[model samples]
Target: MYIITDQLKENGFSVNRLDQIIKRNNNKRQFNTLEYFCIYIIMENIGLIVENTSYNITAGNIVFLGPQKSIEFGKAKGQDTFIISFSSSFYERSIKDSLFLNSQLFFNYNSDIFIAPFSNIEEMRVVFMDRMENFRKKDKSLYLSAAHNAIERLILDAFLHIPTEEVKKDIKFDYLYCVNKFKVVLQRDYKTAKKVSHYAGELNVTPRKLTEMTEYVLGKSAKHVIIEKLISESKKMLSYTNYTISQIAFELGFSDEGNFTNFFKKHTQKNPSEMR
Candidate 1:
């Protein structure tokens, strides 16, 4: 199931009952909830934007979205096509994780990616379309929750094994892209790591490039950002959870409590114990 668009609404975000063909004349006219999660199952064809990324989604392909994603355009293709959207009111977290991870190749504008070709595409399409059809007809015999869960698992199971990594090599990419690469390398090697050289090496870029991107985009050095993220997560554990200081230390890649404490103090101006 592909979802798009979610906003705060009176009923915890209203939902649109989606099934059947949405005509081009009705395109851009918000049906269902303007501010709810959307699951888009395209059977025929539809080109739409999710989270700032454009998709020329094929018939029988699916995409899932979390929040603030939009779905514009109605399904209009030569062969019979079906597209379905599910709001978060019907969302499942495990499924959400699967959807988030599935998006790796595309540039994440506002949408993340999840797509799979089904052998029984037409049958699956009928099943989902029947859902909205039943909703319209008020199918008293169907147990709503059971039907929802079964479909959620069916779509996710096909697409949720492993995710592709984002492509990045040099500094001149998206601001978030560069920073995220720095974070990934930092977490991977933080146990035995440094200011900038350590991370830049893993990303195959120079320290100068790393520092420049971080400073320009974040108004702080990349070094400060890494230390801050580590310290921030550490503070949450120390203050919010009962994990031992040593445990938090090791989790953040500190070898010893003293090292952890000192590092935390340097960044946060408070000792771990005091923060706790």
Candidate 2:
């Protein structure tokens, strides 16, 4: 709901060296509720802290962040990066698929696959520079086609490198695909749909197959993914809202306040009251 696309209306795209962007915005309030898909390719070593996790950014490592995620600049010196940002509107216009964000390349906020290392750092720098120049030109109509292709190439590059089992025998591309689809489905139905079979029915796969796919690709079962997603939302509500525990329990589809507290404590190892 936080529309960051407003700053990108100049060309529906924005590219900047990370140091410059950081220097220009030196305010203490640095956490962003971004509304655009953003890619940050580290040109130098840096540490990126996001919520409860921190990523060690080295040269050639690119971080892909989806909209609505919170991020913070970690304590580091001489950090350099090339950042490319574009609105979902721009992405849909160019790609012709409004639901493209459902893909594993875009979402899956729970996974460590957000960062991937690329060998051709210099070549990528050239590619990003060329795209930036396209945004600068006045008559940019001609650049649209070229820019679209370039963006797709970059996106494809990121998708191809998502971490999977190294043993080719264990790598089932269909399972991977199904797991990603399951992620999208879980995001849409996690609140109302609790059973593994419920999601398996939606994906047209058996509950066992879905669990295997999730374990293989994400090191967790389908039920674990659902519970994690629900608990994540519960924590957000607990931290940000004035809703009472009973109200939150009812909203989250819990049978009762005690049941919600037990479920929360089982996963988080702390009661909801302690969290608040």
Model number with the top TM-score? 2
TM-score of every prediction relative to native:
0.40, 0.60
Best by lDDT: 2
- For residue 36, model 1's alpha carbon misses the true position, in angstroms, by 2.9
Error of 1 at 62 (Å): 1.1
lDDT of the structure predicted as candidate 1: 0.53
Badly placed stretches (over 4 Å) of model 2 are 1-7, 27-29, 75-79, 93-100, 163-226, 230-261, 266-276
Taken over the whole model, the C-alpha lDDT of each candidate is 0.53, 0.69
Candidate 1: tens digits of C-alpha lDDT, residues 115-227: 65565676765565555456536752343544455455655554443343332223233454566456545644555675688788887788888888778645688788677
Model 1 misplacement above 4 A = 1-35, 74-83, 92-111, 131-141, 164-276
Q: Note the residue pairs that clash in candidate 2.
A: none
Worst 10 residues of 1 by lDDT: 7-16
Model 2 C-alpha lDDT per residue in residues 1-276, reported as the tens digit of each score: 123334467556666676556666663325453556777777788877654356778787878776655667655443357767776666665322433444555665555237767888778777777655755474566555455566666666776775554223445667765776676566556767889999999999999999988898778999998998889879877887789999999888899999999999999999999878
